[model samples]
Target: MLDDETPVLDNHLHLDPDNHRGIDAVRDFARLGGTHLLVVNKPSWHLGVEAETGEDFRAVFERTIEIVDEASSELDGRAWPVLGVHPGLITRLVDDRGFSPDEARDLMQAGIDVAAEYVESGEALALKSGRPHYEVDDDVWAASNAVMRRAFERGAELDCAVQLHAEASEDMTEVTDWAEEAGLPSDRVVKHYASGRLEGPIPSVMSEKDRLETAAERGEPFLMETDYIDDPDRPGAVLGPKTVPRRVRWLLENGRDEAVRIAHVETPERVYGIDTEATLERA
Candidate 1:
């Protein structure tokens, strides 16, 4: 949407393999002028795994890294990857597969430990984790919290950025507190699928135009995202990948170029420590 073809980056979206989008979602996003994207992988590894071992968990993680490699190669370095044990996955592992809370926690921690290695190795730029579901039993709620706590702990140990998926507009003080206790800072977190008005030091991957305008006035740092599920059942659920650039263009037309630049470029480069210049050079 830029008049000058300035590359746009999507900070969050699901580009899992075999998505209903026949071609790779990265390509789809890129086709819309999105030069770079962060694949927040939540399902491909767990669309339900039958194997039940710590080793198996590690293998699944290894496969996720492979998927990232394949996508990067296919897209010529525009696809950045993120890995984590989402709360929904934890729910299924315990509720459907009959895992004890402790068992589920152990498996998730194992996978997260492996993902942290990828983070350390620069294979993954960020970690994705949070209570993705709103309503649930007390046990599921507690387990989700425990698993997310472990995610924060790993992010802290590795000093990597973490993307949080939670109920939109919810107060994020709890999450910030969790990060603080995990030895991570609130500024290291990115609030995914956010409503944009939520108050916090944590940056949000936001979409609302009003909030974008407000953020522009307040000089808040944020990133834009579609959170496109990529599931045909929920076709274009939250939005399309083009949403980021479209919003950026609108912001620019409305005289908010500074805000657009901060959200689309500066924040992502700073938070994930990505070499955007190197990424463009790869092109």
Candidate 2:
């Protein structure tokens, strides 16, 4: 039997028809005391599919919503939905097959318009986006803010959260500034994959830790994710299942028990809009 205290939450998972393992994986997770899973529906550049126009993107977004609804209904509280336009795809949108920057911006705006609609519908739990190496163009940043502002407006109406994937400490700062400028609650902006952004040989001593601590101090919730699937070859890429427990142990050892608890404990509840008191009591 799995102990209720065993912490688990797949904060950033890509669930597509091509890669889905079906309900059995979810059942296994639940059987092991996995409290929640936030299924993020964002385009993957690695997969080579791009949603350039609003209508084209809405189709995929709607399909993703359907998937989450199905999974949430089937699992009975094991799964939830997160929606966003990934940053990497933003690059693809701008660097179109053979278009100018102006053309790319026009294309990206179309997708942003559709994302705004999803946020307005209360179907999305949070807004998520990630840059590969923390490098983002001003136009892309502006577009992201426009989308975020629309989401914020709708979030206020529906009482939802905005989850973001910041690739570096600087990226987090830029997003934070935009959210602040938009008057969005600091709490609404949650950071994902925080530990993986460190660049130096000694990541521990780098600014990533400081950035996480600073965010925590500022009342912004930061999420630690394994983003890993079942693959063993890609150990450091995503948070592999086999590596999660060890990572948690390391967090516990490094005086980051609270961070662990925040990532494993508070985030899922917030994202899923669940009452975690009962789960915490069980733990």
Candidate 3:
């Protein structure tokens, strides 16, 4: 089992009090030896916020900060907010809200700007953005790419990391090129739900045995996450909150000590610029 002193951090997770386990799920993670989490904001519609403009995203970002505060105060888990426009929301804006593709693109960029403001204020540590994972028309795809590029720009300006939610792939040269052009290092861009063997962006590999081993074998910095959605209906659709700590314990039992420390401590510190040891002491 992972020792009590080890700092096990989940790179991506969500907590929703209204319809899911919320803080209790975080408590569960803590009970299993998880020390910290990057609590990304859920989509606006999920929180019942009908965002009509970039300023309207304030509600979503505020709620995310609120949730992070709640988790930090009420549980042993240490949490930070990663706020941004979810790429899939572009479709919601265009199809359901009667926005043109260009309009949706502009609004999403505005949302990224708002998220950057949070990062600048220190309420959030990182940004999140990516194109739709599913197939779409060429115009929608182009708009989504535009939004993601804006996110990179904001991340560059803020000098913070950007967590990406997009289709799974081993090659991300195109995305990496955009980050380079935006003046953000490609390593500062993380691919959520990623597996090992990716070519460009840092891989926040899912907390699975084989994937973790593959990422470790890559011989570079990487992080691990469960991507727990915290939805009661779907349950463990992506993975459960306890998965990270438990997987770390499994790795420890198998004598993968360096891998555990590199993933849970070193990579997070480098990517997010947080002191894992200090956070654990505070926790």
In model 2, pairs of residues that clash are 226-239, 228-239
Write one digit per residue (lDDT tens) for candidate 1, span 18-77: 546623666666555566678776552434455465455555456556666665664433
Give the Cα error of residue 96 in candidate 3, in Å: 2.2
lDDT of 2: 0.52
Model 2: ten consecutive residues of lowest lDDT: 198-207
Q: Which parts of model 3 have CA positions greater than 4 angstroms off?
A: 74-77
Compared with the true structure, all predictions reach lDDT values of 0.70, 0.52, 0.88
Any idea what lDDT model 3 has? 0.88
Q: List the residue pairs that clash in candidate 3.
A: none
Best by TM-score: 3
- Model 2, span 1-283: residue lDDT tens: 3245645555666555445453444555455445556677746443345655656666667766776666554432355567766655656655666645555555555665566577667676666543444567776666545554555554444555666554545335555555555666555666555553332111111123454454444333445444544322343454433334444555556776676666566755554455433433232
Q: What are the per-residue Cα lDDT tens digits for candidate 3 across 146-214?
A: 999999999999899999999989999889889989999988999999997788898999998899989
Q: TM-score of each candidate? A: 0.87, 0.68, 0.96
Native-to-model Cα distance after best TM-score fit, residue 193 in candidate 2, in Å: 1.4
Cα deviation of 123, candidate 2, in Å: 2.7
Root-mean-square deviation of Cα positions for candidate 2 versus the true structure, in angstroms: 5.9
